[model samples]
Target chain A: MNLLSIIKRFAYDLQGLTFYSFRLFGKILSRPMYLMETFEQMYFLGVGSLFLVVLTGVFAGQGMALQFSIELADFGSKNYLGRVMVIAITRELGPVLCGLMVAARVAAGITAEIGSMKSSEQIEALRAFGIDPIRKLAVPRFWALMVMLPVLTIVTDFVAIYGGYIIAVYIANISGAVYWTNVTAKLTLGNFIIGLSKPFIFAAIIAIISTYMGFSTVGGTRGVGRSTTESVVACSISILFINFLFTRLLVPQIQGLL
Target chain B: MIRFENVSFSYGKEPVLRDVSFHVKPGETVVVLGISGSGKSTILKLIAGLVQPDSGRVLINGHEMTTASEDEWSRVRPKIGFVFQGGALFDSMTVGENIGFTLIEHTDKTMDEIEVTVRETLRFLNLSEDLIDILPDSLSGGMQRRVSIGRAVAAVDPMIMLYDEPTTGLDPISTEAITELILKLQSVKGVSSIVVTHQITDAFEVTNHFIVLHDGVMVFDGPGEKLVQVQDERVQSFLAPFMQSVKNIPAVCPEE
Candidate 1:
């Protein structure tokens, strides 16, 4: 398509997303909350993802610590590796990595499930029964993700710090007490706020974006596949862009206040 | 009762329905016949208030849907049950859960009461209670359709039933069973219905009242007997192929 047409299509999609998101927000607070479904999703989106998150955290932290220690050693500052690694993991790497990874896994799954429902006419069936599909399906998943992602991020953050310790003290020959002290001393309340808060924002955006894509699905099984793909791509890009936006907008104000 | 007056609809610029006017009375069954892409299912969607008409009025029990708010539509929607072509059972849910979905969502019935109602609905639909706890995907095509019907009626017991291609892509036995259920729902339950199907034989078996649509236009609206007599080129062509196939069948076995 031409640039003009692409721009127009993007505008159209944004308008649709805005309307769908607002309607979903209304249902998120409506009565007759589906508590069981939310808990089930918590099991699926949160607990189900524990192993993957831990594995990601370990590898990421190990790699960062290894590279940082090697560079700092050349300058005779290797002892500061723990402090720098902790700050990086908590302030930036932890949230963004966790958000992107969960966005890929959870967002894709939600889109595929709901897209299949949309294609199968189950969504329409829900409506014909006077039951809101958004309230029934999306609301539960939305709330579950919002509650689960921060908890997952916390797990990722601690595990990553531990992973850094393993690499620094054992592999890099740094003292364990010094490393632990530096890691703990570097973690500020503001850093924790930023770390925990990004996951919540990511969770909300991912939930809404994925559900919106699912609802917009047309065609059939192929359409389900298309929407699932679109949602994963959209969600990953959104997480990155929004992470940058959050850092640019919030970090300064938070630091200034501190 | 459901009524549509000069209703027109389009997806983008491609008109799916145009100036269509028809009414289904209480306890009456009106079968809408059209070929593929002829806007047959669109009529049922309109009746269920799933889509809005661009230029005309749709009334459900004297409530004009064109100007009605979403709250008003919600109040009107429960009186109708939609059985989709593929059954559309929530595959993630067991058969009992699927049947009990509307009840759980809309009614104040306790879990035990809902279980009782689901069992009764399964019995009502002639399905084995053994199938209740199994996922709908594990069931056969015909069984899934029956479970969908059970789900539709298990809840508030909607007075109006909407069936879209109720027997498409089914074996003859399953086709017969669904037609029988449709007839039973009409006569036994006294539920008003608007059935949309391309299966002329199935439509004829279920209802004498008919509405024929072609190219987004209503070609014929009358009884089965009158539909057979319609001579409009579009109407004749639509009915002739099916009628000829029936007529071409030999009366006796070829082995004889």
Candidate 2:
């Protein structure tokens, strides 16, 4: 298939699964949900990804603090270091970097797991059993990623801000009061929200890309690998592209709104 | 009953199947025998609606495969049990869970009811109770096929069972077990079956009707014994590779 046709097919498949998933969710809510499966995925997709999120958060915050201090120090505006760090973390890099991390971790896992299942014909078997693979496989995962990534991004923002505070105040010898003052003064609700919205979009992209990759996998073992790799690469690329789109299109609107 | 009329499928510029037409009636096992890459599995996939034909039509019980709504297709999907060549049992679940999947999905039946069904299906396949609790990995090759068969028949006794290369990679004993299980599934479950195999022995033992696909076209369509009497040189050459693989058969080629 040509690239456009392939993408069109993928989009069609995604739309079909999305509709199917919502229908299954209606069934799920009517009866008992797969409580145990949801919980396990929450732990695996959300909780297990915490360490990487926090690790990336801490270092990212420290780097931002150091960079802002060094740049603004030359202009005798080092006192504004905390303001820059907080804004940077809360409104942009915090969510974006964490999203990239999750694209690597969570998105890759879902793709590989589901892709392997597809290749092994487990997915076919599920269909034979009257189970919609989209419901059993895709929906639980999409819901997990959708709910978890945003929460994880929030935690990442907080952790990054704290890391910046420790580095700017203790290591850079900036006054703690000045740091807190600028941060409390400049960081606003609008900034927080602009940052928060990116992860929701990123989570959706991750869900779409991973589920698409998983469901479309052909061949056998090698195809699963290709799908997993494609999920991560496609997700990371799409995240960056979406980040730019949000920054260009939404950030200025928020600034105007505020 | 499943019917195909002038069905054609192609990937990109190349055609995999062309002008294929056939009907599989209830309670008959139809074996599609072909060389590797002959599109035998593709036929099964088309019947299951996993892939659409580029031209013509496929019907299950007189219902068009192409025009069915998603919910309608989902209902149709359960009636078609597919045992993939690889067994395709979910590795994440235990044998019990794999077999119980259909019950869990379509019905509001209790876990107790589901478990009873799973157990009875397993027992019918002559598998022991110990195999139920273990994961699919712990089972032998033959046992996995049996478990997959059990899972295939778990919830809705399918109107049609499709076996994709049922004896592709198995020891003689395992192959025999699979063949017997294939027979049992057809006879007891009372479902029409389509088995895809390169093995002539498997085709002979497991089918009454046979369709030999060559270059994605149906070359022979008749009773199983009629396949042996065909005067076609190409068919004889195709049958040559698998002939020596059969064990303990008489010298008579075949006579109906």
Candidate 3:
């Protein structure tokens, strides 16, 4: 396809996704809300995703500490390893990695489930029964992700920090007091806020893109598979892109706070 | 009652329905007979407000469905029940939950009230109370379709019910059960209905009025005997394959 056609198709898709997301938001604010379904989704998306987030956070923190400790020891600044780990993990790597992991797991599953429903005409059946699929299906998942991602990010931050502490004090032979002192000196409230804010944006991206893919799915089972793959790829890329934009915008304001 | 006024619809460049016009009176059952891709199911979708026609108007119980907004459509939807060809039961939910979905979401009834209605609806369809907690996939195809019908009729008494190829993939006994259920609903509930199917014998068994669609146009619109007497070569050619089976079965018209 020509570049102009490709650009046109991209714009069309963006427009559709934006329209669908706004419609879902409107339904969520309307009356007769699906409170029970929302709680169910929170359990499914939040509690179900906890183990993977914890695993990813711990390993990422340990690897960063180990690599940085060796590099800093060459310059005889090994005591600063804790400072580096705290700053990087808290302000940058923690939220972004957690978002990516959740996107891969949760977004793909949401797309596949809804796509299958669409293929089977269950989505249409919802409308036929006077129940909007957006209100019954999409709204619950959207609110659940919004409420859960920030909570997951907080848990990830604590787990990763402890993992870094383990590697710094036990493996790197840094004195525990000295390591913690440096870490506390470098970590600021502004850093924590910036990190916590990222998962919210990522959550929106994953939920909106995955649900849109499912809603627009056609054909049948083969079409559902294609939609799932597209949802995951689109969510991952959008999260990374938005992460950079958020960082660039927030970093300056956070620096002023610090 | 439902009315289609010169409704024309197409998927991209291919026309599905071209200037098709028909109406079903209150308490009447109209069976739409057509070959595959002849736009039989599209008629039901249009009546249920699932898809808009490319042109012309669709009216359900005097409400213009083609131009209704989402909220307006939602208000109108509960007055009509739709049975999809594959049953379209939510796989994640149990049979009882699936049947009670509309009641729970749209009504002020309590759980006990809803369960009583669910049990009554299931029993009316000859389904056992023991099958209530089982998932749809675990049921046989016939049972699943009956459960789908039960879901449609569980809550409020819809004024109109649309069935899209209700017996498309079923054995003889299962098809007989669904046909009997359709007839029972008509006699018991007095709801107007439009059944879309390619099955000739099934059509003869359930219809008071018969409409034939061919190449996106209406080829015949009359009673069951008149449908068999259609002189159009296209109509004759279409019915040729099913003619023997249709003759073997006694006509069980709703009017009779």
Interface RMSD, Å, model 2? 1.7
Off by over 4 Å in 1: B245-256
Q: DockQ: which candidate is best?
A: 3
Superposition error at A228 for model 3 (Å): 1.2
CA shift of A194, model 1, Å? 1.7
**lDDT over C-alpha atoms for residue A146 of model 2:** 75
Better of 1 and 3 by DockQ: 3
Q: List chain B TM-scores, each candidate.
A: 0.94, 0.93, 0.96
Compare candidates 2 and 3 on lDDT and give the better one: 3
User: Once model 2 is optimally superposed onto the true structure by TM-score, how far is the C-alpha of residue A113 displaced, in angstroms?
Assistant: 1.8
lDDT of 1 by residue, A1-258 (tens): 899999998999999999999999988887879999999999999999899999999999999999999999999999998889888999889988998889889999999999999999989988888878899889999999999999999989998999999999998999999899898888889888878889989999899999999999999999999999999999999999999999999988888887
How many Å off is the CA of B187 in candidate 3? 0.1
TM-score of each: 0.96, 0.88, 0.96
- What is every candidate's alpha-carbon RMSD to the true fold? 3.5, 4.1, 1.7
Q: For each predicted model, how many residue pairs clash, with residues at least 3 apart or on different chains?
A: 0, 0, 0
Candidate numbers, best DockQ first, in rank order: 3, 1, 2
lDDT of 1 at A165: 92
- Which lDDT tens digits does candidate 3 get at residues B1-256? 7889999999899999999999889999999988899999889888888788999998877878788897888788887889998999999999999999899988899999999999999899999999889999999999999999999999789888899889989999999999999989999999999999998888888875889999889998888777777789988998999988767444455554
* Candidate 2 residue pairs in clash (backbone atoms < 3 Å): none
